[model samples]
Target: MAETSEARASASAPGGDAGGEDDKHDERMLECNICLDTARDAVVSMCGHLFCWPCLHQWLETRPSRQVCPVCKAAISRDKVIPLYGRGNTKQEDPRNKVPPRPAGQRTEPENTSGFPGFGFGEGFHMSFGIGAFPFGVFTSTFNFGDPRPSAAPRGTAQYDEEQFLSKIFLWVAILFVLWLIFA
Candidate 1:
């Protein structure tokens, strides 16, 4: 009897009814727009609307072309919504409510300042010579049309030494062939 009378008195007080109602409204505002429960993994849309990420993700997936905020009907998207973070709430309580994580921002590699791939000696008017003797070697390498130019191999490398050895052999062979033609 006494408890009921006190409760009634409190409800009828000057600051009573309005204070209770305002507190209720504030609590309700934190609820998710779709689930109607306290929001988890909350996200705000560009339209100033709040929602749970899972709920919003499903809503957008349901109507891909017509993604919009449930509260304001304003445009919304997974990439466009900003995630809400609360201190000390990093760990989610419910495992079943987990989402596949938010979309990541796009990135690109810096432009290559070096000349086109395999075009060595670092940028400027380039010149090349054919291997072997004049007319024959000119046809062998200079007019190789459609074939790629071999970049100069670095000194002290096995390839550089091998190339030098091959050049010497070819020079001796060309000399011998010319000498034989003159004698014949």
Candidate 2:
């Protein structure tokens, strides 16, 4: 037992060439099972196999009915795989295109328990009504009065442009209606 322990210590000494070679071997172990190349977008299965996310995604897509690790045949899915982050990785590539993005790490804040001491139930309740005939109702409908409407879409988006165009059309229609009411 003493001789075996001494032999193990000598083999793993910090300054040995064998130690450097062991590092290279460890790196090789991280290579993707499917591509037989160093994994990019690395993810590890629950069964303890490493893979590139894109390669695994394609594999899973190809065999939708049987999602399993290529190496161990253990049950695997996108959510089941844990992403591996390394110090050498620096470039931030967009994960959104063509493939599902890696899951973001979840964070949760502690709940706030303090009650609203100054506020009453009446403050939460708001009710309003409008009583008028057809013309008045049309004018009121033209302008939203109570319960603030949602803000317009952010600028430079398709939804914003469509909303702007629709608002202009409605404005013109409202003007025409008001003019017709006055003249007739």
- lDDT per residue for candidate 1 within 41-157, as digits (tens), equals 888788877788888888887897787788888887777887777786777443223776545657998987755664443422134356776567644543332244456556797
Q: Please, what is the TM-score per model?
A: 0.42, 0.41
Q: Which ten-residue region of model 2 has the weakest summed lDDT?
A: 121-130
Looking at model 1, report the run of 10 residues with the lowest lDDT sum: 119-128
The C-alpha lDDT values of all candidates are 0.67, 0.70
What is the per-residue lDDT of model 2 for residues 35-146, given as tens digits with 9 covering 90 to 100? 8778888888899998888898899888877998898888888778887768876755432233865456579998986665533322222223335896776566555423
The model with the greatest lDDT is 2
lDDT of 2: 0.70
- Where model 2 places Cα greater than 4 Å from the true spot, the runs are 1-17, 91-98, 101-184
